[model samples]
Target: MALKTSCPCCGKPFSAPEDYAGKKVNCPKCDHRFVLKTREQALQEAADLEAEKLRQLEDRRRIELIEREERKHRDRRASMPYYEKFQTGTRPVRNYDPRSGPGFLNLRYLADLLLIGAYAVLMLALAGLGLTVYLKFAGVISSIVILSIVLIGWILVGGVLFLLLKYLAELALLMASLGDQQNDVVRLLLDLRDNTDVDSPEQG
Candidate 1:
């Protein structure tokens, strides 16, 4: 009679002679050598293997659920706006660098120009006042009214001329710098226009 046998390693079925039962046999499929077990022992081993497979499947299912939840959290974060996704503490701080890139003249220079121009205008005004006083004491001007008018006019004209010259110099410098970086200036102008449009409300 033929004995029914199955490989323990690969579970491949094969037929052997009755004398082969309970003897060491090498599995044809897996090449694993083992003593053949009786029907009862084989059934029990298969049951144990099925239980281990179920446990492994449950562990794999648990891992997959955790990974799916993590993926969902990542997707939610990715959907958020840039500002909302990151904390303020993690944001990089930037300091204003005066010499960062090529652009218009420094504002400090314009301030210096204003200060120097104002000082010069004040000195000229003081000189004019002194001259008017000297003329009054010397009897060159007959009326105090005429002296006052002359002094006032001198200071006003001198201050205006200084301011005009300063503005013209600043404008010339600005134009030259803008001409040199024409592309960058154009981009800056476009950005300014866009910002202005965004800020302004549309009229019905």
Candidate 2:
């Protein structure tokens, strides 16, 4: 049919006649640059765009149909008793408890490894200090004093690091435990409400 084009910058519409094909021109309204297309090429492009829109509409319709089916299935399952819900095996029970947090991947493991590494490093430091002091002083009374000082420093630093790490690890575990307990209480409350609602209908 006829050629139709819009300004690339201002999006103003314009018609391209047969003489304007393959010509470069500025839009009259916005003075923006755009190339005019041949009538046949413009028609083909329009067809392609219309085909793309139809395909998208079909895809959306298919998705909506699938979602509607799923909703219907969920309603059917809601009508079924709890024990019979999984009897068909079509829908498996997926009880993923988030409060348990990532299974084996957690901070406690890293904390334990850090504690072990810190212990080994401190022990090595103590050994190195004793060796250096013994070599430099060579069994003098000053050597005993230096070794005592080194031992005391080692004890103080090591104790602080160890206790800090111990507290941190225990605190992490305690926090996780408290979170799980809170979730358990919420879940129990929900179950209690559900049971009361379900039983009230029967009792009435």
Candidate 3:
């Protein structure tokens, strides 16, 4: 017996042997080979293709959402001021540039310089006090008293010197970075007085 069927590839109606109902065949009109699927198998394949298309669409949506979030983060970062991004002690000191325009003075740098100057004055005062103590008590006081005074004076001087050295180290870093830091106290104070008017954006 012959079976009536249509070629899916060429859309040509043709007759096939009944035994060819669920087999592969070639379309004579288009010379295209295809599987002659049963009605149930064809339905299952169409359902599977639709499911795959849905999965692909969902994946694309998720990727688009991720890209949108990334763009928002970039915009937020771009909107922030240059100064807000820098943290103290995180930046490495750079070489001083003489030609670079005098930058604004940093309040923190001025405070460090003040502390160093105070320590220097304290050292001078301590020296004078030690000299007075030695001259006044050298002849009448016991040897132990003289030794104790010397020891105390040396300890105080050592402490002040240690602090002074630390301040000097900090000052060196400030000077090295003065291309960004201010050139002098006057320029620094002037900038401080007019900070709001200064355009301090990061320029390329």
Winning model by lDDT: 1
Q: Kindly give the number of clashing pairs for every candidate.
A: 0, 0, 0
User: Arrange candidates by TM-score, highest first: which order?
Assistant: 2, 3, 1
TM-score of 1: 0.33
Deviation from native of the Cα of residue 150 in model 2, angstroms: 38
| Model 2 agreement with the true structure over 27-90: per-residue lDDT tens digits | 9798877678887777888899999999999999999999999999999988774324534222
Instruction: Candidate 2: list runs displaced more than 4 Å.
Output: 1-3, 88-204
Residue 43 alpha-carbon offset, candidate 1, angstroms = 1.3
Better of 1 and 3 by lDDT: 1
RMSD of each: 23.5, 12.6, 17.6
What tens-digit string does per-residue lDDT give for candidate 1 at 117-192? 7668767877887898899899999897998899889878887877776676567567656654685545444444
Task: Mark the 10 consecutive residues where model 1 has the least summed lDDT.
Answer: 88-97
Model 3, position 151, has a per-residue lDDT of: 65
Error of 1 at 74 (Å): 0.3
| Candidate 1 off by > 4 Å | 1-3, 8-12, 15-21, 25-33, 81-84, 88-204
For model 1, what is the error of residue 116's alpha carbon versus the real structure, in angstroms, after optimal superposition?
38
